[model samples]
Target chain A: MSLAELQRMTRGRGEPRVKQETPDNKAALAFLGPWLVGVVALTIGPMAASLYLAFTDYNLLEDPRWVGLANFTRMLGDERLHKSLEVTFTYVLFGVPGQLIVALGLAVLLDRGMRGLTFYRSAFYLPSLLGSSVAIAVLWRLIFGGTGLFNSLLGAIGIPSSTSWIADPDTALATIVLLHVWTFGSPMVIFLAGLRQIPREYYEAASTDGAGPWKQFRSITLPLLTPIIFFNLVLAVINSFQAFTQAFVVSGGRGGPSDSTLFYTLYLYQEGFGAFRMGYASALAWLLVVIIGAFTLINFWASRYWVHYDD
Target chain B: MRLTTSSARRTAAAAASIVVLAGLTACGTGSAPGAGSDGAAPELSEEEVTLRATWWGGDSRHPLTQKAIDAFEEKYPNIDVVGEFADWGGYWDKLATQTAGGNAPDIMQMDELYLASYADRGALYDLERTAQLDTSGLDPKVLDLGRSEGTLYGMPISTTAFGILANQDLLDELGLELPDTSTWTWEDLSDFATEVSEKSGGEVVGISALNNGYSLQLWARQHGEALFSDGSVSISPETLAAYFQQALDWTASGAAAPASHQAEMAGVGLDQTDFSTGKQALAFSQITQIPAYEAATGGATLEPVKIPSEDANEAKYSYLKPGMYWSVSSTSEHPAEAALFVDFMVNDPEVGGILGTDRGIPSNGAVRDSILDGLAPGEKSAADFVAAEEAYIGEAPEITPNGASELDTLIARYLQDVLFESQTPQEAAEAFIAELDGSIQSANQ
Candidate 1:
């Protein structure tokens, strides 16, 4: 078609739409292009490959041989997988709720008018920042060791102590859970932000209505902070499910003291990289995505009952 | 959702243009490496070949390795070497990804723990034929570690022997003689450690009670056990039980640090503890760790001795372990060049002098001698000690299971369980065995 003919054919299409020069659109495209590439290359690429890998027997060396859900089948019979699931579920069960409550409680306490609030807030939040760090994990091990600072302090107080708090299987997971709780600063900060968002008028009104401090907290603060609490709860669940660095560093990346600290993601990492079971690891990864997704969805569903967004 | 006549055409045209642009970009990236499409060696040119090499090391080793690479580049004007270094913590994860992406370095520093995994995956080039490497000068044991399926996938860079480093000064004060390492048993080590603690009014223990890879290996050896035999989980129930009992007994009697303390040390590593602080008389480590040990102890004199074993004749307890290996990526277009670089790094006298026992005694005998001769006094003493121990190492054991590395975590966790709570030896042992079996089974499938 000739340019003249093509122009003539479209001439009657409403008023000739004025083409806008959108520097913003051009800039947005330019800006997002690299980000899109990175997401595809670094994140989505592996994710897509992992999905494919889940059904195959792809060791890092050879070509992936598709076995069609054999990995999932094997997982059913895998007692270690079962144990890891149990341990991980237990971790998510205890760690997520425990961390949220503590974080919220601390956030509330820190929100009160008090001296050295900044210092106390920083000191508590400091662990959250450093909690996942290798150094902090090492320090945690030392503080909890039988001859560690904790036992040493106990001894100084004339309490007899045994040398192994972290080594005992029963207490090993608990120690990690305590670690999860100690790093409550992240959620605490979120809760603090949430607390600040609630107008002072609600609490004041509650006070005016002859509501005691406890009643005010129960009726106003708790309801108002529900969104943040829910947010923290969901985040904690996902984070707990994917906990790797702590368990890895604390247990020397072995997830042990009898596999008590073997978080699900750590096991996935071990399978994929350490054991070279990339295929199985991919399956595990997808399963985790499903697990986290389910938990997050469930939390969202549960939020319907408790989370109050005081519009 | 509805488009007018001109708008629909514009949208279609835009989509077509996008498809073309993306296609072109993909083709451009895909074609970049294909410029040297022929797998044949490149035609000689004046342009320098900037070869990228990566390895994991601490700050101490980084400078030395950089210096060595610089010296190599200086010697070979056509080769410009780029060095990428990281701490050991997550090195393997990076290497594995690089391998998967088919952009692995020309030269990669590898660990014995990963040699099989990398080689089996074809992520590493067979250096033997490609380099036509003459192993006439290399240690047979070190050479053996680099071999997979009768082909050499890597060249051993150095040797390390795991053992207990006793603080001689502490032992002397306690009037406790270092046991005859060759004939000493675990029981002897434990008993002596307890005696020192009791006698010294709990001021010191005979050793830093730490659960480590060396401890696990040593324990397996002591009970005539193998952590993995013939590429299988072969640790006997009796051996596992004995190992657990020994750890528990030591912790219970206060002869060693409690499990939790040891667990703490697990992350920090045994090199950073009361032993290095000049308090604990003995600590477990590899011979290559001597440099770090000496530095941490403030130049306090230290010696590397064998991990005490029950049977003196059984060499299962101790063997010359390769500190590191130089591997050429299988995907490399220039395998010969990579192999040549490895050969130069290992056998060249100048490179050896610069490296100077930095990566353990060089796997090559000639290079080891050069490094030994060039070493400063302290390093020279370490070299001498290693030479003496070398004569006593028996037949090197078979390569461990593909999942052998996972067992280290299992051992550490079992020990951690014992130290933290009142878990019995049987419980820890059963858990370890079960976990090991599970890991091995999963790996096999």
Candidate 2:
């Protein structure tokens, strides 16, 4: 629509509105220039390339040739791809909730009037900063390895477990889940901030009405904190789906113990770099985008029923 | 060495977009010739060329390599060599990315698995065309192993022969005897291992499972088959199944560490293995890793012994394949200088003396002899072992064709299936062969 038409429509609705350039138009455009370049260069450009590459046979070395839907067709019969999807979905389903529960619990505990709040917050926040790092993944492996710290602890308790938890098909993914839960620091901080934003007067009113701390939490604290919970859930879902490094590191990039920890992203890497089937890897990448997008959309649809706001 | 690489892929995706970033191989025989094959240093320009050389190794390698580079700089004052290195997995990932970006290092240390992959993609310069890299000093058989499409793309740097590194100290402590590895059959070894497990009350396991792709390859060779032939998964399913059967028997019979422990150990470097940690009595590894294992075990006496065979005749399956190679990038601007540097690495006594048997027994006979006296005790014994075993060494097999670089991962996955009882050996082998064949077909397409 033309500027005059937009202005006329606004004017017809209510107060007369005018469309004109702001004083900072040039400055704002200049300020956004670098970001625009970045979007076109890094994000949009690669995404467009990936979209195109998804349909063609591009091995990242040779020139891409047209191969219509072969990569996708191949995925239909791929057992490993299916396994990876299952693994990734399970990780998201269990990991996001597990992490959110841990995060929310710690956030509530810390939201109390406690001394050294800053110290506790920093200490609790540390894992998220180092969570996806290679060093931490190696540490996680050692902690759960057959002869490592965890087994030693078991031995000390006279349980005498010798299983390398990260190396057993039954327990491998569990260790990663625990690792995911341990890195709940970021969400806890968010939840803590959200808890603070819930005015104390609500709890006081609940108390006057003869509500216990548990009742106060269930009625007052929870409803107001749904937005943050929703926010953390969404972020956790997306991040967990894209989880790669921990599985890659712990499995040594083979996605082993019978492919129990084969995250979708790790499978994409195996196809793209390990197998040099960049075309198939691209198809896998687009599939993940679709999967994550569909889930996020579903989350949005579901959030409308539960999420609440003061306004 | 193993390095669980950082989540660089995630960072790359976030920072630069998806992996399908823009780039194409500059399609052509883009490489130019290097120096002449005069068995002398390439004539250097006075302009002071700077070349980047990269390799993968553990902690001890970086300093020794830098010291060798220092010597090379002294020899060719005008050429400055910059060194880059990483653990095995990270090195390949980084090198692949760099090559895709057309910014690959001038010199790269290539593995048998990946040498063909890179060269077939025209990512490596042809050494014969370069004329600067002299192959005359090395055995022609060793040199030919580095060739692809009848073109010499990489030069052999050293030799690798897979063996069982027996921890004599561990056996001695337990009052058990190290088996006569030369005469022992696979069945004999298993029974002996079972005894060790029983004697030790299951504390120290007898051996590590055969999870290394090299061991599988050697096993196939012993059975008169090949894991791969002509860029295809050509091993008979029966052969691979038998290998898996041995693994199953070892685990079931308690002749080796449990599958859980094997899964953990399989993904690590020699230095971190159960054998190196002195928890296990044996490990199957390349003969070159003796020093690293000794150092890891705090100077424990580990001796290299032949892998089990039916007889001396079957011992011919053991071959001194190139442990690794030195290749100049096809896109290198300083190919001549890079060629000279690689030449020095292969032939110079100074480099070999400083490097010792770290890279393996030297590929050049003269340099191998020259450095023998200067080697440390473990390295010297390892070198002596390689020399002694030469009589039994088989003809070096062809470097695995392009698409087989991932065979290790493929085999390890299938082995896990067998261990978990999720698949029978025959079933896992059948599935593995199908998957491996498809992988090769797709890459070659």
Q: Could you list the chain B TM-scores for each candidate?
A: 0.85, 0.89
Lowest-scoring 10 consecutive residues by lDDT in candidate 1 chain B? B26-35
DockQ of each: 0.27, 0.43
Fold similarity of candidate 2's chain A to the true chain A, as a TM-score = 0.93
CAPRI quality of model 2: acceptable
Residue-wise C-alpha lDDT for candidate 1, range A48-106, written one tens digit per residue: 56677799886655566789989899888776677789888988888888888898888
Question: B147 in model 1: Cα distance from truth in Å?
Answer: 1.2
For each candidate, what TM-score against the reference?
0.82, 0.91
| DockQ computed for model 2 against the true two-chain complex using alpha carbons | 0.43
lDDT values for all models: 0.73, 0.83
| Chain A TM-score, each candidate | 0.89, 0.93
Q: Write the per-residue lDDT of candidate 1 for residues B204-250, one digit (tens) a residue.
A: 87765445555565567656676666666677776776677776788
**Prediction 1 TM-score vs. true:** 0.82
